[model samples]
Target: MDWTTVEKNWAAYTPRVLTRWPGLDEDEVLATDGDLDRFAEYLAIATSQSVQGARDEARGWAEGEEPADAKMDPTRDNERIFDSAKNIPVGEDVYSADADFGDDRIPEPPMDRKAG
Candidate 1:
């Protein structure tokens, strides 16, 4: 499949995925050129060339022939964008601490070992 089609599909599916797990973001879920290229390469290797035209061209390279397509630099949006988690300070009030000692204390030790 073309990268645009794959990305469009991902965009459509992003909401459902987010509904299932709110932690994930749309950008991260969308496919990147790198991801598409890898997938296409794998498809070319694993499946018959006739099955998918996209694989037909890459099948040779997948089978060890040199790649025909020149590798391109990643786009600005190629990588997923994410906001780092905010650092929240924890206060002592959140956790209470208490220590108690018995009325009886340890006796003094002998000053000299030889005395024993």
Candidate 2:
């Protein structure tokens, strides 16, 4: 009843136990120390498909780590921000007030939307 044998057996059995219950944990295996062999055998019986499923989940998580869930906290890039700020046109004058003109010489285009 060596712990290593049990541990290795547990590791091998883990995927099997996980097949039926994807969320099963190592604690479940350790809980039955006396019946490690029987549990390992059970794991042997039940784990093939479930172990593969666990593997798939692990691989999916590994592959998907950087996609959306692994998003880090928002960061501030002061250099980039300053770079963009420097590019702002310095000479351009922006005015909100309208100009006052007395003469109306420009012909205005029809405002109504005509049928095409």
Candidate 3:
């Protein structure tokens, strides 16, 4: 596949991917060519297919075509790594420490029902 086709596929498929995984915002998704390339890389790995094959499969998905046979069982390690990946935020500060807004805070731990 040519660079133009790769780029075009990236642009078209990105929004569909984001919609499926709504935890990520489009702005926080494929913002650059490198990011788009990485997206394709992961997709290919997950499907156990070549980059071009994965791109073609995903293009069908983006076009509202019947689902192609791009899916395969990812390895356990790969699944864990994919789950662990943090969403890349755009134009926003990502504080290492999480903060909860003030006012209503739970001070005591709830009793475990399983203990009964």
Candidate 4:
């Protein structure tokens, strides 16, 4: 399948499931926000290319030839778009903190060493 078709599916099906069924009910799959569709679109495009590339590479390998894309960078990030995830600050409030123990706590001793 072409990437355009996958992108189309990403655009179409995204809104239908926005209000419900992001995945499961409990745990981290809570919000059915529309933002996830962007990820889906990204993944779909990546997956199609990846699958096709893998297939072509494998075929080339089987024929005793190097894969055409084997030496090329799959993601040519000229503007560092994909790298933003590393710089982004996520999970700001999903986690809660408890009270921290202070100077009054006793330190546990290290395990006693036995003769080798």
Q: Scored by CA lDDT, what does every candidate get?
A: 0.39, 0.43, 0.50, 0.36
The TM-score values for the models, in the order shown, are: 0.21, 0.20, 0.28, 0.16
Question: In terms of TM-score, how similar is model 4 to the real structure?
Answer: 0.16
- Winner by TM-score between candidate 4 and candidate 3: 3
Candidate 4's residue-wise lDDT over 36-59, tens digit each?
Answer: 443444333534545445344323
Question: Could you arrange the candidates by TM-score from highest to lowest?
Answer: 3, 1, 2, 4
The candidate maximizing lDDT is: 3
lDDT against true structure, model 1: 0.39
RMSD of each: 19.3, 17.5, 15.4, 20.1
In Å, residue 41's CA in model 2 sits off its true spot by 15
lDDT per residue, candidate 3, 1-116, as tens digits?
23444354454545557666455456545764424456556667655789888666555545453122222223235744665556534533444333333334545446664422
Q: Give the 10-residue window scoring lowest on summed lDDT in candidate 3.
A: 66-75
> TM-score of predicted model 2?
0.20
Question: What clash pairs does model 2 have?
Answer: 16-47, 19-50
Give the higher-lDDT candidate: 1 or 3: 3
User: Which scores better on lDDT, 3 or 4?
Assistant: 3
Judge candidate 4 at residue 54 and give its lDDT. 39
